[model samples]
Every structure is written in structure tokens, then in C-alpha cells.
Target: MTLSVALGPDTQESTQTGTVTSTDVLTAPDIPWNLVIWNDPVNLMSYVAYVFRSYFGYSEAKANKLMLEVHKKGRSIVAHGSKEQVEQHAVAMHGYGLWATVEKATGGGDGSGSGKGKGKRG
Candidate 1:
């Protein structure tokens, strides 16, 4: 599978081949986003871990680690994707009674925190 686009004049044509990934979306190029879940008193750690497992299909260990990060570090980035998708994830998190937000993913700048855990922006 391949995708090629010609963006009018003054721009070099781009070609994408093989395993087309989400980040390959030509709309925004290299700028991806993340879904950050904040720790809240109401949701139990067990429930938080459950959310990660059920919603994200994360392994028990990975989910527990992320849950621990939220509990100890105040927050954790649970997933990453485009603005629309991450925003939907945030909303779903809210529906599950967790605090979540979507922000532009930074490569170690703009104070968005480190990109770690099982983010889906690959």
C-alpha cells in the first residue's frame, strides 16, 4: 500500500509506502496529540486499572504501571492520537469519572509532560 500527494506549487511531492500508520495522516504531518488522565479521589485504583484494561486493552502490568503513575505523579498519558480521537478518549474518560485532557504532543517541550506509557500515536 502506498500514498502519494502533490501539494500544489513550491512543495515537494511526498510518498508514503507500506504499513500506513495513523501518524502518516497527511493532514497534520508530525504533530500528534495525547490523552492525559489525571488522578482523582473518587475513582479507585482498581477501577482505574480496569479502565485501562477494558478501554485500552492493556496488559495487567502495563495498566497497573500507568495507574500508579496517575496516583503518584498526579497524571499519566494513557493514549495518543489526532485531536479528534484523543478528545473522544478524554470524553470517554470523563464518562468513566476520570479527569482527562487532550493536548498537542511535544517532543520534550511546551510542558506537555514526557511521552511515555502505551500511547496510541505510533
Candidate 2:
């Protein structure tokens, strides 16, 4: 069964009346959080890539890609994990003299979700 409400012309909202049967609860793009790294002028592009490789264990190509992203986009996502883990990564980045922060991901999620780690250098 379903119930619906219309607030505008030819528009409607619907509520389903039934038990869920194991359908996916959320879409892929709605991850809940991320750790975003901002870029600065102090770190060399090569050094930044090296950091990605050494700290995050990213492959040379992947590290370079993320480093390039940090260079071009001024930020990048380095790792993904629980909030606690990402927070630790952020603090670690700080310890490494990198700029880093954790934030809610760009889209909404079901509250139980993953987050990415962030790192930056200037």
C-alpha cells in the first residue's frame, strides 16, 4: 500500500506501507563523510606524491594521481574509513606537517557510512 501528498501542480510525495525485503538502503554516491586535504604553496608536487605513496601506501601511479589532484583541485581524498580512523589520519597528517581536515561527505547518507581521509601540504 502507499499514501501520497501533493504540494504543487502535478507533483506528489508517496509513502509506502509495507516491510522492506532486503533492497539496498542507499545509493552509491551518498557516502556520509570525507577527509579533505587542502593544498598550499610550500610542498613540492613530487614530495606530495611521495607522501601519498609512503604514508597511505598508495601505488606510485595512484599517489601521483592523487597528488596531481591536490595540485590541480587544491584538495584530494587519500583514504576512506570510519570517522575515528579518518580523524586519526587527519591528526597524523598534521604531525607530518600537512594540512588536513575531516568533513561530512558531499551528499547525504543513512548515517552509518564510510569516510575518506584527507592530507595536504604547502
Write the residue-wise lDDT of candidate 2 on 60-110 in tens digits: 877787777677767776654446666888998888777898865433444
How far does residue 103 in candidate 1 sit from its true spot (Å)? 0.8
Per lDDT, the best of the predicted structures is 1
Q: Write the per-residue lDDT of candidate 1 for residues 1-122, one digit (tens) a residue.
A: 11111111111111112222543334554455767787778889999999988987777887897898788777777776557778988889999989998767655433433322323322
lDDT of each: 0.63, 0.55
Best by TM-score: 1
Query: How much lDDT does candidate 1 score?
Result: 0.63
Candidate 2 lDDT for residue 33:
38
Q: Count the backbone clashes (under 3 Å) in each candidate.
A: 0, 4
Off by more than 4 A, model 2: 1-32, 106-122
Error of 2 at 39 (Å): 0.8
